[model samples]
Target: MSAPKVTVLDYGSGNVRSVVRALEHVGAEVTLSAKSQDVLNADGLVVPGVGAFAAVMKGLKDVDALRLIGRRVAGGRPVLGICVGLQILFDEGVEHGVRTAGMGEWPGKVERLQAEVVPHMGWNTVSPPEDSVLFNGIEDERFYFVHSYGVQHWDFDVSQPMMKPPQVTWSDHGGRFIAAVENGPLSATQFHPEKSGDAGAQLLRNWIGRLGKP
Candidate 1:
């Protein structure tokens, strides 16, 4: 079988080349696309973002990426988000006293980590849930993180029977923040998997493998 065709949405906010290279290294036929339709039709989609929340949202909006992601995810397609890309999946983002609306795929807010030292840079280990597919064999390894803002908590309605609880991963700095989340067809990581070493490559491979199923 041919490698899964993956597209890294180019919304003018993230490390596009690095993400493309990482996905390619992990056995994906990756394309960097600025087109919304390409994102809608990809076998797997990656939204990678770096920098501020508001800025990234603006870039996504410019290309109608938020709608594309929401529509694709609602249809049960596989979508992976990285760093600020993951942050924008939440309801809103509070940065520097300003709150910007996110895509609202999940109920939560992205805020600055309440740590003495901002921008949690370098490697850190994450505690993944018992049945996480993304962390398959690399659960014990460390992943690279470089961000000050993160989703401090998860908010989901337990009353909704159809909504399965997400497989969550946690990591600590001054306090604990969401390291990764696997919710059905949607997955995200607060850390930079592309910057992470062998462990990160494995994580990407694991995600890619899922794209070939069903």
Candidate 2:
């Protein structure tokens, strides 16, 4: 099969070059575009963020990406958010006592980690659920995390009889926080898979592999 067409949403949050390169290395026909057509037409969309929560939200708004992402997910198209990209998918984020509204896709808040160490940098292991496609064969592998804030809790109820529950992956820095989430067409990670080397590559591959599935 031909490489899956993936578009990396470029909204000026920075640190996107490495993400684009990583996707290309994983056999994806990647396009770094802010065009609405490009964002919605691709087989997969990647939202990469590397900055303060408020600023990232501002950038997304400037490019009209919030609506684009919502439309994609609503249509059952795939979307992957990285770092602050993941954080912005929630209800809101509080950084240094300032609260900013997020995309509100998930009902939660991103807050500063209650850890002794501020930025929880470096490699860390995660506990992915058995049905996770994102962590398929790399469950024991560690991914690179470089953030001080994350969604520390998950409160969304997926207990309806017909709907499948989301697969939540957990990791601990000062306490247990959401490391990754696989909820239908929406998936995200607090860590940077592009920078995680081989293990990260496999994780990205796993996600890319699910691009065209029904």
Candidate 3:
């Protein structure tokens, strides 16, 4: 019944500070992993992205980190991806670079926003992924978002879900990006939950509550 050990991957995305503070506030033994060793050993991991997709992927590659991350998650580690971090989980993204495949978790591609104005910033609505535990104790509402691209939707391997939920698969990362997607022990958020005020805090706290001791 003690706090969980959580690691926030700080790749210069700028939101790790608040996430770390918030997790610690919730009694989590939080560690900021800028080094590969820290990252590979984390009980739970958070991948934060605050810049362009190509650059972010390059940074992860520079350190050969995402494969290690994939290994951990594949081993049943609870992992979370936020914003751009969420987008890169797909098979590819078209931001600033050519068609580059992702870590291949979500099995989709990232693309530039269809919005006339790039960088879809501000508060936006996020639909819950039907019984998403990450949404426990939380009301469905608007969350802060600042991105030019998002997860182009993919059909979940329905045969494998512990539960099924409703979703819209737009050409743009499955119709929308919200809340978060659940694939095994992996949950990803395309919006910045850390900046979503009370709702955001509840979202994060719920996520920590769902983790197991490593």
Candidate 4:
């Protein structure tokens, strides 16, 4: 009954420490690192970033982390990304291009919400996706979200099989906007689960549960 090793990427993101603390709070043997090897060796990886996508992208590249991330996912290691980390998994980002282009795992664009004030920040409702391991224990769950740019055209790039992939579960926010997505061992969320308190802690547990190695 050994605790699982979970590595949280600390690529100079503002909330990396918070995410590590939260993961530890949920009993994960958390390792915080800016190193690619640490991520590659871990049983699971969590990428949490807050700030300009371009800067985050550069940080990842500086340490040669993106290649490791790609290899890890390809090699069957479970992975998760939060907030901007998830947003950049696509092809392009239109928010303050301090950093541009995505890791391109999922396809889409990140754009500022017009007609409404940018940077929607606060707690909002999340529609549960059936069989979502990330939503293992929750109801009427409202988590903290802070961002000006929201996802658009996610379904277009996401393969139909992947969109409905047996392993890919989703939490829908705006019918089309993907709040959370899971592909096999990899999962992501646009909300700050660590800042969301009890429910956030629950999310950590749920993802850990998917490791299948107790």
Clash pairs for candidate 2: none
CA lDDT of each candidate?
A: 0.92, 0.94, 0.73, 0.77
Error of 3 at 73 (Å): 1.0
Worst 10 residues of 1 by lDDT: 155-164
Who is ahead in TM-score, 2 or 4? 2
Cα TM-score per model = 0.97, 0.98, 0.85, 0.88
Q: Where does candidate 4 have its weakest 10-residue lDDT segment? A: 166-175
Model 4 per-residue lDDT tens digits across residues 113-212:
5524446778877776666778876857888888767675545433455355533333433334557777776688888999998988898898887775
Q: Which run of 10 residues does model 2 get worst, by summed lDDT?
A: 157-166
TM-score of 3: 0.85
Better of 1 and 4 by TM-score: 1
Of the two candidates 1 and 2, the one with more favorable lDDT, higher being better, is 2
| Highest lDDT scorer | 2
TM-score of 1: 0.97
128-152: candidate 2 lDDT, tens digit per residue? 9997899988999999999999999
Q: Estimate the overall C-alpha local distance difference test score of candidate 3.
A: 0.73
